[model samples]
Target: MEWNERIAFVRKAAGLTQEQLGQLLGVTRQAVSKWESAQTVPDAVTIARLCEALHVSADFVLLGKEPEPPDNAGDAPPYALPDTCPCCGRPVSGTICPVCGYTLPTTPPRGPRYAIVASRVSFVNEEDRAAELVKYCGMPESYAKAAVHQMQEYASFFLLRRNLTDSAAQWIAAHLDGSCFSLRIVQDNGEESNDALLTKPKAMELPAPAAPKQGGLGFWGVVGAVIVALLILSFF
Candidate 1:
C-alpha cells in the first residue's frame, strides 16, 4: 500500500477519526483528508507529529516498513509509552513527543557550544566597551577587557571567543549595536578546536623584478673583443 494508505490504516488502528487526528496534529480535517487521499503529503515536521499522534514510527508511516524485533526481545523489559512530552510538557502517549518531537536519545546528549564572531566593529572607549560586554554579554571583567583590547588592535574580522554557552553568544549578538559591530553566533560541534569565520586575507606585496645587472658586457661584445685582440696580435 502507498504511504497515504498507510497513514489511513494507522489512524484507524489508533481509533482516531480524521477530525480527531487533525485536532491532535493541529491541522484541519481537510488537510488530513488530503493526506489520506494522496492529494498532498505532509511536511517533515507535520509527519513527525503524525507519527507521534498515531504511535507509529516514521518508517512505518512513510515506507510501510515495520520495526524489526529486538534480538534479545525475551530478555528486554516491556517499554512503556510516556504520558507527556518531557521537552514541552505536553500530553502525549508515544515514544516520540508530539509538542517538541523529542525522542529518547540513543547516545549521550552533548552540551552545545557557541562562538561569537565579529565582522566589523566601531571605535569605542575600551573601558565603556568592556563594561558593556560584562553587563550585556555576561563576560568576565578581565576577559571583556582583553576582548575589547583585541578588537581595538585588529579592527577587522576576528573571532571574539569560542566555547561560550548559547545564552552568552545570543546576548552578545542581540545586545551589541549592529552599526558598530556586525556580530553573529556560530554553534560548535562540541570540539575544542577554534573555528573562525571566512574572511579575505590582505593582498601580499610582491618584490619588484630585480633590475638587469648593471655594466655587464654582452656575449657578442666579449666575442668581438677576443677577435680584435687576435687581429691586433697578428698585426704586431
Candidate 2:
C-alpha cells in the first residue's frame, strides 16, 4: 500500500481519527490529513513515532502484506469483568448485554424448569450448555423471565470466551469503561450449586462449603455432646 493509505488504515484500525493521530504526533490535523491523502509525506521522525504509537513496525507502517487490518476486533467486547453489567456483574444470568444492550442468545423454556445437576453441569461444554440454555430461554416463563435473561447474557459470555471470536468478547469490554473484566472461574465439584454471587436463585440452592468445627455453643456436634452429658447428670 502507499504510505499515506497505510497511515490512514492504521489510524482507523487503532480506532483513532486523524485529529487524534495528529495530537499524538504533535502535528496539525491538516498535516495528518494531507499525509493520509497522499498530498504530503510526514517527516521520518513522525513516521517512526506513528509506527511506535500504532504498535506496528516501521516496515508494517510503510508496507504490509495485507495493506490493511481486517477489523477483526470489531466483534468482540471492547473489554471483559469487574466491568460486566453493573446491574449484574458477571451475572450467572442476564438478557441484555449490560454494556451494549445487544440481546444475548438464550435458552427457550420447555415444559419443566431447566437446570443441570451441579455434578452434571460439566457434562455440557460451554457451547452445548449455551445452545441448550438459549433454546430453553426462548420458552415462556413469567417468573423466570429476569433470571432467564441473566442466564442468556452469561451464556453469550461463556460462548464468546469458548470460541476465538472477538465480537463476542467486545460486547463485554465496551461496557467496562475501557477496562477488562476481572473474574475467577471455579470448576463444579459434582454438586448442584447456585451462583453464590446472584442476589436470588431460581430453584437451585447455593452450595454451602462445609464449615470448620468450632468449640462454640451453636456447634451442632459439640451441642449434641453437651446434651448427652446433661442427660447423664439429670439421670444421676
Candidate 3:
C-alpha cells in the first residue's frame, strides 16, 4: 500500500476524522483530505507525527511497509527461562534461542520500563503519555533516554521486516500506564501495540552534506598557504 493509503487507513483505524487528524497534525481538515487524496506528499516530520498519532509503526505509515517481525514469534517458549517469561516471555538464559538463534542483550535493563507487567496503558493518540512516563517510571530524560527510543524504533523496524525475532528485540512494550517523555501513543485494541509517543525521539539523520563544502574548491587551503608565505617573507 502507498503511504497515502496507509495514512488514510491509519486515520480511520484510529477513529479520527480528517478534522481530528488535522487538529493533531496542526493542519486544516481540507489539507488532511488533500494528503489522503495524494494531492501532495506530507513532509518528513508530518509523516512522523502521523505515525505517532496512529500508534502504528512509522514505517508502516510512511513506507506502507514494515521491517519484518522477528523469527521466533511463534515458537514455543524455551524451558530455561520458564515457560512464561519473568521478563516479557523473551526466552533467555540459554546459549542460543533453541527456537531461533537470537542473542539476548548482554544485560537487560531494569526498573519500570523493563518488564511487560509494568507496561503503560495508553489512550489512543495520547501524546501526554510522555510526561507520565518521566514522572512515574523513573525514566531519566537524559540524552541517554534517546537511546531507548532508538531501541524501540529498532524493534519496530524488526517487526516491519516480519522477523520472528522482532518481539525479542524490543524492551517489553511499556505498560500503557502513563508517560515520562512526552510521547504520542495509540491503542487500537484491535491492534496490540504500546507506549504512545516520545517527546523527542533520538536518532541521527545525515547532516545536510556539511553545507555543500561552501564556495570554490580549495579556496581556504590556497589562501592559507599564500598567507603563510607572505608572513615568512615579511619576517625575513
lDDT of 1 by residue, 57-152 (tens): 766776567899878777856555446433334455544443333343323334676666665467556787777566554567898787777777
Error of 2 at 78 (Å): 12
lDDT of 3 by residue, 1-236 (tens): 76678788877755467886787667899989998888976655565555544546654665455668679765755343223223233333332222222234323423221112122232343234433333223334452244345434442211110111222323122232323222222211222342322222322221111121223444344334434433543465
Worst 10 residues of 1 by lDDT: 202-211
For model 1, the superposed segments whose C-alpha errors exceed 4 Å read 1-113, 156-158, 161-168, 195-236
Candidate maximizing TM-score: 1
Across 1-236, the per-residue lDDT of candidate 2 in tens digits comes to 76678788877755567776777667899999999898986655566566655655555555454446557747655432222332222332223332223333322222222222111212223344333323322222342333334444553222111211123233333332111212122322333434431222223322323232232344443335434433543465
- Candidate 2's TM-score: 0.30
Model 1, CA-based lDDT: 0.59
Q: How close is candidate 1 to the true structure, as a TM-score?
A: 0.32
Q: How many backbone clashes does candidate 1 have?
A: 0
Candidate 3 Cα misplacement greater than 4 A, ranges: 70-236
Model 2: number of backbone collisions: 39
Better of 1 and 3 by lDDT: 1
